[model samples]
Target: MAPPAQSPESDLTLPIRPGDKPPVPLPTRPTMIRGFTLACPVCGTRGLFRRWVNMVERCPTCHLRFERIEGHWLGSLSINTVVSAVTLLALVTVAMVVTHADPPIPLLLGVCSAVAVVLPVLLFPFTRTIWSAVDLLSRPLAPGEVDPRYDPQELAALAAERAERDRAGDGSGSGLSDPGPRTRRSDEPRPPRSSRPHDR
Candidate 1:
């Protein structure tokens, strides 16, 4: 028989354990807005970077590690490149349209060069957060990725959600399908007989 279909929220529901960190609830618009504003994508805390090029190791508020995995910043670099290219293309198009037949080649080159250099620098920080948000959205938080102390409000909301799911007859109170009881199969491997003689 085919497995039962699960709701979208049910997919996001993680199994709660005693020492496990709570799952970070990612609301799309709000998370993206926070990223655009150059704040912590997971927690919305500001001033994450001390320098324009240097971001802190982790978020102070939620302790979210910015670089979730190795080479994570590569996504941010790609985002920066794409944004810079788009900005340059738009500016060049506008300049060409305005100048028409009397386009000043030297002036256009100078402006483009400046934009190429500056826009990436200006967008660097924002791109990092944006990419982080995008990554988080694409790949939901794994265990131990964020800080242990989850936000009180978020925890409360999650608890309420679980309660509702339980009341709705989801079977498993954890919002997942219960396998019922375990039954060992005949084909399953059995422990080998002891070679040593039994002690008296």
Candidate 2:
């Protein structure tokens, strides 16, 4: 299907390409906040999630490997837990403080229970994305970590990278530079001159 046309005035004119390298994430604060909006931290695009909590395996725009690895999202569990704990505590604290530290037990119980159930579920996607951003930033995607579809391109990029590294003396050893055009005499063992024929 054809994409919808964009007006020239639209932000579409902006340059936001992620480049060939693994995503260079924005600063830490912006990165984490991007998660709350369910934006792909790599490209700042909100098309990463298919549903509220249903994340696409890979980013549609930059093709970043979202999961990165199996069970990598376990970090989000910590994010959710911490956020949930803080939320529940904050709510409880406010209720008690408002009621002179003696808020009704039933009211507190009901409210906390409801908030606990709803907050986690509602924020699951956010925490997961947030965690993903943190993880991505901490472990900048290397060439080998890219999606399989990008292997050819990444391999080329990697080769270029290694070449540059070798040039810069970052590799184990530098490559020998070409010594100009080869002279046949210098390049090959001169065949024994046909001494007998030449003598004639």
Candidate 3:
């Protein structure tokens, strides 16, 4: 079954498929660019955290759940690592080329070391929020995807949804996929275990 519609308060600007329109207007800026503001990607609420690096459970305005799943920020780490590595490599290459392949080692070491410490710290917010935008672009938010702990009311609702899906006509869903009935050929007994290599 199709997922439920998104909330009108969602502020992220995403591509529109044919014949689909958001209930609310899209943000003026692209979602990734807006993500750099460290706002909630869905609602663009700037107060997404209590302090540096400490994200709130959900958006205060739209209640869109951040940390959609455990380890959702793992990709942020990858982003930071790749960016830092590339930046460091670029710095090293520039120093080598400008200084005739023998740049001041101490200065290079100091600059790279400081960047190693500062870049990740400064980019933490960007990395995480941008990763959210990337994730959202790849997989648009589905109905009832919020984390359970942050929204207890959704528990009952999701339960009902799953139950209804299960109760739909058998072909509509897949779980056990049980064959309701079976017939025996000629009503004959099966072969003995020793002779039934095909009957695991």
TM-score of each: 0.65, 0.57, 0.57
lDDT at 113 for candidate 3?
Answer: 100
Sort by lDDT, best first: what order?
A: 1, 2, 3
Clashes of 1: 0
- Cα error, candidate 1, residue 34 (Å): 1.0
Per-residue accuracy of model 1 over 51-164 as CA lDDT, tens digit each:
998999999988888898999999999989998999899988898789885679899899999999999999999999999889888876765566645543456567989999
Top candidate, metric lDDT: 1
lDDT of each residue in 8-100, candidate 2, tens digit only = 888656565676444433467766778778887766778676777788887776687778888998899888889899999999889888999
Tell me the spans in candidate 1 whose CA falls farther than 4 Å from its real position. 1-25, 151-158, 161-200
- lDDT agreement of model 3 with the native: 0.74
In candidate 2, how many Å is residue 22 off? 11
Kindly list the per-residue Cα lDDT of model 3 for residues 40-121, writing each as its tens digit: 6765678776777787887777667667778999999999999999999999999999999999889999999999999988
CA displacement after TM-score superposition, residue 152 of candidate 1 (Å): 10
TM-score rank, highest first? 1, 2, 3
Which lDDT values do the candidates have, in the order given?
A: 0.84, 0.76, 0.74
Worst 10 residues of 1 by lDDT: 147-156
Sequence-dependent TM-score of model 1? 0.65
